[model samples]
Target chain A: MSRLAALVRGLDPRLKLGTALFLGPALWLMGLVQAGVCAVALLCIVAALASGQPLGGRMVRGLLVFVVFWVAVKAGLDAVSGMEWAQVAAGAGDLAVRLAALLLLGLSLALSASARALGLAVAWAVRPVAGGERAWKLALSLALMVHFLPMCLATVAEIRQALARRCPRCGFFLRMTVIPQAVIRALGQKTWNQTLAVAGRGLDGPQAWEPDFSWSGRDTRCALVAGGFLVWISLSLPFLS
Target chain B: MITVTDLDYVYPGGQGALDRVSLSIRPGTLVGLVGANGSGKSTLMALMAGLYTPTSGSITVDGCVNPGEGRAVRAVCRLVMQDADLQMLGATAEEDLLLGRARTDATVARARELARRFSLLPAWERPVQTLSWGMKRKVCLAAALLDDPRVLLLDEPFSGLDYPGMREMRGLLRESRAVGLTQVVSSHDLECFIDLVDQLVVLDTGRLALDGPPDAVLNHVRSHGVRPPCSWSAGQGVRSWDEESL
Candidate 1:
């Protein structure tokens, strides 16, 4: 696992995302909705894996849930306006591609960039916007919160289990109110204990994760390729219309 | 140096767990809080451990004392806690050790070293859930000892240990104390605690009844039957085991 982590440290996270974005619109122009988009999205998935991000199962389940939502939204839209099959396909295809790209891009970014490194990168990238002590803290906290987002997901599952009962109005009420309330009720000593542990040690200092990027031939070439892809995609927009 | 004077604690449900309790523990003494179940032993320990606030009276540590100051109080004095399962906050054995020491480069090696020495489970990078009850307890103890604090508060330090295991534990505690570490281990088992604790405390209900040397208290309790006289006064507290054997 440590070796795998070391291997991931070799690749540039930005390059992975750039690759996905470059391929997405290019594939859309190729008129191969499922094949091209799927290929691009699948490549992004491979990047996520190579970066040591374990999201295969999570992505599968999330896409399944998104399918249900897409169907419901599609049905509502069809009822409101009679649309042609080409338009429907485009809408659904775009929807699927957009969703897949977003998911895979997110995974790539997460896998390639660590919380500390990303915080440093963000702190560097958004220099003017992120210029205060509070801004730095906010950026660090946001990074930590994003990194620990999966912890809250387990709580959501627990809440769903609690709401696993037969009802219409009450079930609706629970769906609306249960999750947040359950989280509140379930916040126990462990969280406070961990915080106390950190605070007690005086370890909660300003995380000066200053970004350190060095320009190499690979980086320069990658950036040029990315820029060209964007230009091509921009020119092809009218053709799609 | 914690002095609990007329300390009383009750739960939110209006359950009177602790009555007025007064006790003073001098520095450099290994005190063990002991009692039967529901005797307010854990309640008073909880007050000292900073888990709960006394309803009335004062709970002080090293002359600096306050009620419900567990977070601050706990900083000076660390508690390993009674429940081992609740102590784990990491995803894996290595991560468990890295819970607080994540920033350091030697954190993994340090954790692995302690895990090996302290009988921590899942020998590999397996999840904490894979460990046994005893293994979890050892890991919790290792985590507590990692900081090497001025004071160590252990609840049932030897609950799941055999004779040899307890001896190994004693060696660990001995090493911890050799360097000015004040330890308070709250436990009911005084039999195996022959060489472990230096001081003894008995909580009869939420109130303190006995505080003195372990040997003196042990002899007194034995002579008068485990339950002391309904009303008793302190004199020459614990007679050293020179009379018997430590």
Candidate 2:
């Protein structure tokens, strides 16, 4: 692994999550040039973290498709609202960069840590306000969501493929209606089965939950780097604008 | 041991999946559950795994009552669901194998040992989504076995497996049985279980239609919407689908 990747992976998950949470709003509020620089930096970090992982390339490609599609929609809307062509292009580009940065931040965290670690981080973050039991419950729910999101996506894709095979020339309107209903039914059944599977593993309660993380010098360094980056972004905002 | 006495499971929608089903499974024996679609095979396995409380009757696994001692029953029984995708709740094979368990060095070692035994160590760190259908099933099986439950309930274990995958699953089942782990495998593919299972239990429209040794139940499975193994129809008495047997 690259040094950057090793550093991020060894950093505590709570620090990674905290950085992402802070960086999201920071990216959104930044000037276009600043956002672009941050986006590029985040992308590199994401790439480093994604190295040697199977789903990394797919995630990056998915992010590209998402950004492009949304940017096109946003630009078209701005044009319809009678915005100047130059402004429309600039606004769309800015939105695309910020969106990509946010997604890259999320992808980096996901690639760097396991679901359990992220879940524990969530629990720790929420424990003060939500109480121990409720915090753990929320954390477990988040972990289950992370675990099943891929399977849900795969199911949706399979349903779409089956529908296409059955009716090659199906209307777009019909597909929109049919697909959601089918997906909901399929996912509902899957959720029930998953609940049973989870229960069978004796995870219905939070009594056995334990955090498998500890602080280290690397974590301290990571927090310091994140703090410095945020400070730099704040200090440069006025000059960039 | 698993004991089901007059088990009736009625869904909230007023649909009955299992109706007065009664059966007993002795410890360490492999029981093959056969039926048609919606014949309650899956429901019975879920009930045995303590996923659901029987609507009227009772299910006891390793002497733990289903409704009364749900957690204890769950501890003693593990169910591998029909869709391996649904059962897996981990990003990677190793993660899934160690799900719901303490992540100590001993547990991690045990998970790796199970993975190696299942030939899953090579894909130990690979995302579960990238695995083949058979490999995904193996990962679920390995995860189910990690807790060392007394009874393992497998729903449609052979649904998506090819010849080699099926052979590997059969081998795993045989190994588990040898270790005195009671197993109830629900499958529509009777051929895979004919020569391997100690008892064949057939469910017909939510009722027990046949329960006996494979030879006795093989001839009657056809009446319950299940096809008899091809060899049985060919007058080959209780033959396995294994290539060498063929």
Candidate 3:
């Protein structure tokens, strides 16, 4: 892979999350206008491929589920609003594709980056404006969130497996009882102790090792390309509208 | 060497955990800290590990007061708590072992070696939460030993291990002792580590009840809510605890 491609793999998760946060509304607006649907899809495909993670069966299933749910909800609303079937189908298709593109952006970012790096990146981003203590605390909290995501997923899977064996026909109420208890037990002590351990290891406050995140020449080129694309999109916006 | 002088520790809620507990641990010796549940073994180990400041006394590791010289104390001593799940901070077993170590070829090699020794080679890259309770404990042990700390304190090391796992841990302790690593193993099970420990310290309700060589003080273990080891009982040809009465 090229340097930019490799850099994207290790890019700060904060940047990726920020990009998604910014792009999400843009994609939503584009969907509303029924414009740039193809462009957004192309960007999603490129981002996914560049992330170097295969669209696994589970991810595909999840995407399909999301798309189906979106279309169903749209159809329901349209039916209640007395819209024709053809118009409803078209609008729902547009919304589904747009939502898929947004989800792809989030998945690409989540799969490619590390949480600690994201926390550090958040710290780095807010360093100029935020006080040192506030930045560090925010960084730690963000890092904890990153760490908790996978742990929560694993806990759910574990509880599901156990429940499947013990009470295969159990209802949602049983899961409500068991899962939270198990997850809490699994997650509660670790966070507190690990945070203390981080402090105990003499790494409690602000991180000592500064991350080298200075934009390289390649990054400048990429930025230029992105700027050109943004200009092109802005210029096309008037025509599309 | 580790020294505790009139060590008194009280929790924030004003509950005493260790009361006037004082002892000197010789360099490179394996000590067994046996006590009943809530008998302050964990608290004592945590204090010696520099995790807590002594409320009214001093604990010095190699002449450095623990609370005052925490960094210095941590540089030489490592504490592996009873709950391995809480102690393991790494996402994966390998990461936990290499947590604070410099990411060099030598450090990685040492981490791999320790993982192998602890029977965690199969799950070296596996997330710690996916591992079994015994495997998690082993990973924590490997992480503690990865830095080659001079003083290793284990709280209930054999709590969740099987017979073979316990034997493996005992062997590791012996090897660590052979390599001049001082170890304090705190456990409720006397039979598991009784023979291996050169010194045995008994705690009863947050106070030191007995401290001496294993044979000398093993007789008094029963009085402290801890059953005396089989060897200690059998040595006197007594099957019942009351008959061996010390």
Task: Put down candidate 1 lDDT per residue, B166-239, tens digits, no spaces.
Answer: 76667667766666677888776665454556778887665566778755676565432244322223444333
> Model 3 shows how many backbone clashes?
0
Pairs that collide in candidate 1 are B1-B62, B60-B65, B216-B238, B216-B239
Error of 2 at A229 (Å): 1.9
Calculate DockQ per candidate and list them: 0.07, 0.61, 0.21
The residue-by-residue lDDT of candidate 2 on B137-184, one tens digit each, is 999889888878899999999988898998998889989988989999
lDDT of 2 at B132: 96
Docking class of 3: incorrect
Q: Is the docking of candidate 2 incorrect, acceptable, medium or high quality?
A: medium
lDDT digits (tens) for residues A145-236 of candidate 3: 77677667877788789888999899999889988898788777566666555554434556432333545675566556645654544544
Runs with alpha carbons beyond 4 Å of true place in candidate 1: A1-6, A9-60, A107-183, A188-241, B1-21, B24-30, B34-75, B82-112, B119-141, B155-180, B186-195, B202-205, B209-246
lDDT of 3 at B111: 85
Question: For candidate 3 chain B, which ten residues in a row score worst on lDDT?
Answer: B237-246
Question: What TM-score would you give candidate 2 relative to the actual structure?
Answer: 0.91
Taking all chains together, each candidate's TM-score versus the true structure is: 0.61, 0.91, 0.73
TM-score of chain A of 3: 0.79
Error of 1 at B103 (Å): 4.8
lDDT of 1 at B103: 45
